[model samples]
Target chain A: MKFVIQRNQLIASVQDVMKAISNRTAIPILTGMKIEVKNHGITLTGSNSDISIESYIPAEEDGIVNVEQIEEGSIVLQAKYFPDIVRKLPEQTVEFEVDENLKVTIRSGKAEFNLNGQDAEEYPHLPKLQTDDSFEMPIDILKSLIKQTVFAVSTMETRPILTGVNVKLNQDKLSFTATDSHRLASREITVKADGINDLNVVIPGKSLNELNKILDDTEETVEISVTNNQILFRTKHLIFLSRILDGNYPETSRLIPEQSKTTIHVNTKELLNTIDRASLLAKEEHNNVVRLTTLENNIVEISSNSPEVGKVTEEITVQSFEGEELKISFSSKYMLDALKAMEVDEVNIDFTGAMRPFIIRPENDDSILQLILPVRTY
Target chain B: MKFVIQRNQLIASVQDVMKAISNRTAIPILTGMKIEVKNHGITLTGSNSDISIESYIPAEEDGIVNVEQIEEGSIVLQAKYFPDIVRKLPEQTVEFEVDENLKVTIRSGKAEFNLNGQDAEEYPHLPKLQTDDSFEMPIDILKSLIKQTVFAVSTMETRPILTGVNVKLNQDKLSFTATDSHRLASREITVKADGINDLNVVIPGKSLNELNKILDDTEETVEISVTNNQILFRTKHLIFLSRILDGNYPETSRLIPEQSKTTIHVNTKELLNTIDRASLLAKEEHNNVVRLTTLENNIVEISSNSPEVGKVTEEITVQSFEGEELKISFSSKYMLDALKAMEVDEVNIDFTGAMRPFIIRPENDDSILQLILPVRTY
Candidate 1:
């Protein structure tokens, strides 16, 4: 393989592919990135067992030539040092050449590096995902959906399926839900879909996090295709593939409360700040439990007490209140996580009782919801 | 104890004292910060046996009120959570009141935190350093001197005394030197002194690192006092005390070479970048050795070769070169460290053949000098 490429373009592509590369993989060849030189452009691929990423640079695009003078061949280079070397090269353009014996030489300015390359034939082959169950959505909106629910996924591997976010589609509505038995987060959005509907898939939350980091916040569209055991997300210059979990996700609809004994509307920022301060002492105890009590006036008291280290108490004025007065205790970390996910001026919290789960949603929008199970703080 | 202080001022003082606090200290009281309310202002102190830092905020300084409503008393609060709490307080001013039973109440806006406080009597008292030998220098100059020599200190515990920087003062000249047996760095400056002519002490490098972090970059004077076993650095609002190492520092003056067989002048930045790039491949072999050879013309060849990995070579133009043609190999990391410490446009390097030690200094100044021992390469 022989090619001359722009240094900046190569750096960007290398970084995108490197997100899926991990040094701890059992397969030795999987730690190397495969580079292929073709007539169209150069393709870089990085893969572990669970996820694979491919980023391509075109020969010429929009009156600018990113790559030229190509001799078609393929080789796999160690991912550990290649990216760093490319980033620190002193010239604007980098020249890469691989001999018939797979000895790769990279030269830029007065600096040159020769690295041992592995045979590309030893690299694992990526499964070709072919299915008509594909859809397109704006990258920013997709990123928001991932952010709203990915945090609620179970980090513990006791139940491996809970580590993924449940994605379901019906008609033109797409819903993403994640829960860890203690709390749940759900978001819904409308998107244009193809013929295939009634599709469901469980994608690991870790894969979504890596995908979200590489994706730029733009109005450009990302095409998503789903198969039996794999899913692919394709953009103009990148392609991401992730394996789907093979277990049925637990039913989470029954976990959210349907009725409320008390409802209160409060400024989101004020309540978040109050709970944040109250949790300081609670963190020392490792429980991070805070109690909220509704008062007769438009006021709510948030407090936390640690037996050895004293206590903290704060009061916040709510916009409105109704139904019966109530008191509830829950993890301050979970409350903060839910509050941050809801980007609204005011939030409506619905409480059933001291022991039942409570739901929080935007005051005027029902597209997103968060529910938390109370902790027994007696 | 009671006092109301501006939140920003309290945060700054707490951060400064926290530099001396360590979580792994043997004495439990050392992990907490002592806060004393006095008629003039409030004082916060943190200690870890090796170092103690005290930061005071005056009731009124430069026509601005930082503290008010002070009742003379003192209490020690847990340093782990106090800094975070003070930073997140919601009001401009925070009121702290300690009851007779040592129950501390901190109030800001509508938020209140009650924390258990230990009696200040149990805290370790800072040793008073009474010495007639004292000197004054600009804070920025002192900070620069520490940075130049601290990196060369030995990190191994085998040579306990080498873990500290040797400081010597004579007449009006002060010099700092540190070495790890392989390389040495020395810097000297002239400061105003009183009552002392010859003095020598070794301060632990760890303490200097913490002190350097808290000291601001300014032209204000810092008063330094040296005793038999301790050194104190006092600024306008802070007093930092460090225990001196209890051993005789080795004689490093003889390590510098007296005469050289060859001398070369080069731009500091160009040599640094060349070495950095040449070291990349050398790092894989766990021995970062780079070789430099002086050619006939004003050019130097920098190269590194790893048996498993390939080799790299680059040539850089030098300002001037003289003496016998020579080739030398040394650790790129040590060379990089020495080059970074010299804040000069051009540097003069003197070599004594290929086996003896070499000296590097600024082109025209003698205030700073660096010596590096060459490595034996087959």
Candidate 2:
């Protein structure tokens, strides 16, 4: 492979593919980044057991040449040094050349690097996932959907299926659900899925997190395709593929409480800050649990005690309260995470009882719901 | 004790003193921050075995009131929670009240934190060092001096004295020298010490690093007092006290070669970048050693080889070169650190031979000097 490429474009594409590269991969060849040169552009691929990423730099786009002197070939270079070498190159353009013996030479300005390249044939080829179910959504919306529900996924591997977020598409409505049993987060968005099959897949939370990092917050559309085992998130010039978890996701619709005995609407930021301060002392406790109590005159008291470290209490007036007076304790960390995910100014919380799970959602919208299982506290 | 203080000021002061507090201290009381209220101001103190810092918040300054409703008393609060609590308080002003039993109540807006406070009497008081061996210098210069030399201090505790930077004052010149026995960094600045006594002291590199972090880069004068066991750096509202390391520092002045067999004057940034790229493959080696070979026409080749990772060579043209041609190998990290600290456009490097120590100094200035011993390589 011989190509002279714009350093900035190469750096950007290398960083994008690097997200999927893992040094701890069991497959030795997977640790190297595969570079394939073509007349159209150059493609870089990096992969681990969970996800694989391919980023492309077009030879010419908008009359600007990103790559030239292209010789159609392929080589795999060590991921460790290739990225750093490209990043620190002295000039705006870098030239890459590979000989038949697999010796790769990278030159820029007066500097030159001779690296022993691995045979590209040894690198596992990511099978082109053949699927008819494909849909498009704005990149920003996809990133938001991932962020809102991914944090609630179970970090513990005790239930391996719970480590992934459940994505279900029923006709035009697309929803994501994540739960670790202690807390749950769900968000829904409407997508034009005309002629698309009813899709149900669970993507690993870790993979989603990496995808989010690589994706820029733009309104550009991203085409998503799902297969029996692999899911692909394809942009204009980049492709992200993640393996689907092999298990049946639990049915979570019935877990939502039918009705609430008490409900309160509060400013999202005020409640978040109060819980954060209260948790300062609660951090040493079992779950960093803090109790919320309804008081007279639409006011609620949030308190936490660590006996050895002292206690904290904060009273915030809610926008509205009704039904019954209640005292409930839940993990402050869970509440904080849930509050942060909701970008709305006001959130209404519905409580079934002290011992049951409660739901928090935007006061005006039901699209985002955060549910927390209250701790049994005296 | 009771006082209402501006949240911003309180937060800044707390952060400053918290630098001295360590949870791993053998003395339990040192883990708590001591707050003492006086008529003129309130003082926050945090101490570990090596250092203690006192940050004072005056009642009023420059017609602005930072603290009000001050009642005289003192108490020690857990450092872990106090800083976080103050940072996340709900209001612009935080009111603090302490009872006789050391129950501390902190109120901000509708939020309140009741924390258990320790007796101030139990907190070990930092001894006020009595010494006439004192002088003043611009804070920015002092900070620069520390940064230029402190990084060279030995991190290993095998020779504990080498872990501290040798600070010396003779007549009017104040110089700081640090070395790990392989590479040495030394910087000097002139201070007004006409009446101050000559002094030599070794200050722990860790403490100096913390002190540098707490100090803002300003031209304001910092009064420094040196005693046998402790050194004091006092600014307008902050006093940083660090314990002086016991033992005499080894003489390092003789290590710098007086005559050079080869000298190369190069752009500091160009050489730094060249060394950085050359070190990419060198990182897998023992000391990240890179070779510099002077060629004809003032061209110098920088290269490194990792048997398994391949090699890199970059030839950079120097501005000027004199004396005999030379080839030397040294740690790229040490060279990078020295170049970054200089902040100069060009540097003159003097080499005695391939095996002896070499010196790098600014082209037209001698205030800062960096010396490195070449590594044995075939």
Candidate 3:
């Protein structure tokens, strides 16, 4: 294979695929990126056993990519040294030529590098998914959906299913849920779909993180297709695929409390700042517990204590409150996480009891919610 | 002790002195900063047994400070938590009060903190140094002197003296030298200290690094005083004192070659880039050695080779040359450092032989010079 491409265009695409290149050498072939040239464009794909990313550069575009010579062939080049060489090249265009035995030569300006290459035939093929159960969503909306709930997913290896985000698409509404038993985050949004197809696939949280890093903040649409064991996300010239976890996800719909004996509305910024100050003293504790008490006038007391580090207390004039004069203790870190996920000025927190689980959500929004179990503190 | 100070004023002083407070608990008293209130001002000091810093906040400083209650007393407070607490306080002015038992209460807004404090009598006082031998220089010049040559100091523990930078201030010029036996970097600058006493001292490189972090990018004057065992740097409200190494520094004057048979002048930036590119291929080699050879018409050829990782060659045009054609191999990292230290458009390299030591300095200036020993490569 032989091709000459613009430096910036090749660099942008190479960076996107480099994220999926395997850093481990358990399988030596997995460390190389497979390169293929066709009459239309050039494609670069990197894969491990669990995830794969493929990006394409068209031969003729809006003056971004200029292809001088294109020979239809394929080769696998070492991903480690190839990207560094391209990034540091002193010229605006890079020339690539591969010999019959797969010894690739890269030339730019006055510098030339000859890298040992592997046979592209030895690389594994990516599974092709049928488009019968595909859906289209705006990239911005999809990015927010992943960011809002992905952090709460269980990172431990005990329950393999909880390590993935559960996506449930029914009719025109789509829902995403992630939980680690201690806390849970859920979000629901509307998307456009062709036929009535329900997808209840569990995607690995780690793979979603990689996908998030590669997805830029653009208004374009991203088409998603799922097969039996793999799911693919295709953009303009990028394709991201990940293996699905084969297990049953827990029913999180019942985990959120339906009733509350106490409700309080406080400024999100004020509560975040008060919690941050209290955390300094509470951080030494194993659970980082902080207590909150609502008074008659619209004032709430936030306090934390440590046996060796003293205690901290501050009063925040809340917006509104109802029900009994309530006092409860919970993990400061968990409360901080729930507060950060909120996007409005004011947030309402619901309390069922002193020892029961509670829910936190934006005061005006009902599509997103966060739940945390209160720690027993006397 | 009771006083009220502006938040910004207190924060600035606290940050400067906090540099000497080490996190290790091996010395318990060293973990706290000593606070002393006098009729003139309040002084705060922090030390780590090796270095001590004292910053003074005057009673009336251009209407920035307002001392409400003046009680002449002293105390020691924990350094780790005081800075964080002061930074997060909700008020513009912070009130500090101490009880008979040395218990300190810091009040800001409606929040209050009671911290355990120690009597200042137990804190070790810094050695009093008379200003018999002092010199004044521009802070910018002093900072530049430290930054240009400090990175070459040896980090090994076997030879503790090499871990410090040797400073020699003569009648008209001040010279700084640092090395780890493999390579040396030296820089000199002429000053206006005509009648100043000649002095020589070795200061720890780590202390200079901390000092650099606190120095502002202004043309303020910095008064430097060298005592028998301590060296103090006083600038405005900050006083930084560091313990000097108690050994003779090695004489590096003879290491610089006085004569050269081969001299090549090239653009500093061009040479730096070529060395960086060639080093990429030589990274896996034992010493990361890159070879430079003089070609016809004064063109310099830079190349590197690795049997298993291929080779790279780059050609950079020379501005001028008055030497025999020679090929020399040296550590790419050392060459890069020498080139970086010379702040000039073009540099002249004096090479005696392929295996002898070489000198690199600005083509127009003779104040600063960098020397590197060539490595034998077969």
Candidate 4:
């Protein structure tokens, strides 16, 4: 295989595919990136046991030539040093030539590198995902959906299914929910869809994070196809495939409280800062718990005390307060994560009781909700 | 003790003293920062076994008030979290008040932090260095002198003295030299002095690095005092004291060749870039060796070949070449370090022969010199 391509274009494609490559893969060939040259363009593929990523660079896009003198062939090169070499190449354009024995030669300016390439045929073939249960959503919306719920997924392997975010689609509405038993995050949005409904799939949170990182912030559409055990996300120049977790996601709707004994509306930034300061001393304690108490005159007091490291207390004025006065203690880290995901000036917090899970959401918005279980402080 | 200080001033002073604090110090009190509130100002001190740093925040400097409500007392606070707490305080001015029992209360805006403080009596007292051997030099020049030679210090602990930079003063001239036995770097400058002649001392490279980090990049003069076993560097708001290495420094003057068979003047930047690119493949090999061959017509060829990873060659045009033709190989990293330390547009390279040690210096300057030993390539 022989091809000459623009350095920037190649670097972009390599980075996209590198998201799926991990250093500790059991399959040796999986650590290499498969590069295939065709008449139309070049495709770079990287895969681990859980996910596969393919990024394509067309011969010419928008009247700008990205590749020239292309010959059709394929080889897998070690992904470890390929990205660094391409980034540090001297010239704007780099030429890659592979002989019959898979000896790859890369030349740019006056510098030349010959890297040993493995036969592409040894790479595992990605499963062909074919299903009518597919939907399309804007890349920015998908990225937001992943960010809002992925952090709540359980990082422990005791319950493997909890490590995946439950993605469910019914007719025109799509919902994502993740819970680590301590905290839960859920987001829902109306999306344009096609042939199927009542579809449920649990995608590993790690895979979703990698996918979100590669997705651009543009409003372009990303076509998502779901099969029995595999899901594929296809964009114009990139394709991502992930294997679904092999167990039913536990029902989490019952965890969120429907009624509240106390409700308060507060500026998100102000509350976030108060909790951040209160957590300083709390972090020294084992549970990292900070307590919030509603006082008279619509004021909320946040405090944390460590026996060995002193204490911290912060008072913030709330926008409004209603119902019975209440106090709750929860993980400061969980509260911060929930607050950061809500992109709003004001947030409405609902407390059921002192020892129950409470829900927080953007004021007057029902699309996204975060629930945290309060820790009992003796 | 009680004082209200500007947040920025407190942050700056804390950062300056933090250079001397390390978590792995054997002395438990060294892990804490000693804060003394005096009639004139507040002083913060951090010390490890090798070095001690004290930074003072005056009550008023240059007609600006940095502290108010000062009460004379002292306490030691844990250095691990002090910097973070001060940086994240809510208000522009932070109030620090210590109770009779050493309970420290820090208040800013509506946020209040109470930290447990240890009695300052347990903190080690800094030694008083009253010496007639003293010198004054621009802080910028001192920083430059440290940077020019510190990189050559041996990181291996086989020879402890080689891990320190030998600093000497003769008459009014100050010189600094460092070497790893394989390569050497030296720099010198003349400075105003008093009662210091033929004084030689070895300062640990790690201490110099920490001291260099805290020094401001201004032309303001800094007072330096040297005794038999201790050295003190004092600026307006900071005092840094470091213990000298207790061993004889081997003579490195004979390493630099007095004669040259071939001399070439080239742009420092071009040669650096060429060697950087050539080292890409060489890095994959163990030695990281790159060879430089002077061709006919004032052109230098830089190349490196790895048995398993092909080869790379780059040709760079030089300003001039004299004497005889020569080819030499050396560690690319060492060459890059020597080139970067020389803040000059052009550098003159002196080569004795293929196997002998070579010298590099700024085209017409004698203030700094670097000697690098060539590697034997079969």
Q: Which pairs clash in the backbone of model 3? A: none
- The Cα error of candidate 1 at residue B220, in Å, is 0.4
Complex DockQ per candidate: 0.76, 0.89, 0.54, 0.70
Ranking by lDDT: 2, 4, 1, 3
Tens digits of per-residue lDDT, candidate 1, B1-378, equal 899999999998899999999989999988899998998999999998789999989999889999888899999998888998999999999999999999999999999999999999999889988745678889999999999999999999999999999999988899999999999999999877876688799999999999999999642988899888889999989999999999999999888888899999999999998899889888858478999999878999999988666777878889999898999999999999999999898999999989998989998788999999999996
Candidates 2 and 3 compared: the better one by DockQ is: 2
TM-score of chain A of 3: 0.96
Better of 3 and 4 by TM-score: 4
lDDT of 3 by residue, A70-96 (tens): 888898887877788889988998898
Arrange candidates by TM-score, descending: 2, 1, 4, 3
TM-scores, each model vs. reference: 0.98, 0.98, 0.96, 0.97
lDDT of 3 at A41: 88
lDDT of 4 at A40: 90
TM-score of chain B taken alone, every candidate: 0.98, 0.98, 0.93, 0.98
How far is A279's C-alpha from truth in model 1 (Å)? Answer: 1.2
What fraction of the true interface does each of the listed models get right, in terms of native contacts kept? 0.77, 0.89, 0.42, 0.70
Q: For residues B182-298, write the lDDT of model 4, one tens digit per residue.
A: 899999998777766677999999999999999996439888888878999998888999999999999888777889999999999989988888888788564789999999999
Candidate 4 is scored at a TM of 0.97
| Winning model by DockQ | 2
Candidate 2, residues B199-248: lDDT per residue as tens digits? 89999999999999999964398889987799999999999999999999
lDDT of 3 by residue, B189-214 (tens): 88776446598999999988888888
Clash counts per candidate, in order, are 0, 0, 0, 0
User: For model 1, which pairs clash?
Assistant: none
Chain A (candidate 2) TM-score to true chain A: 0.98
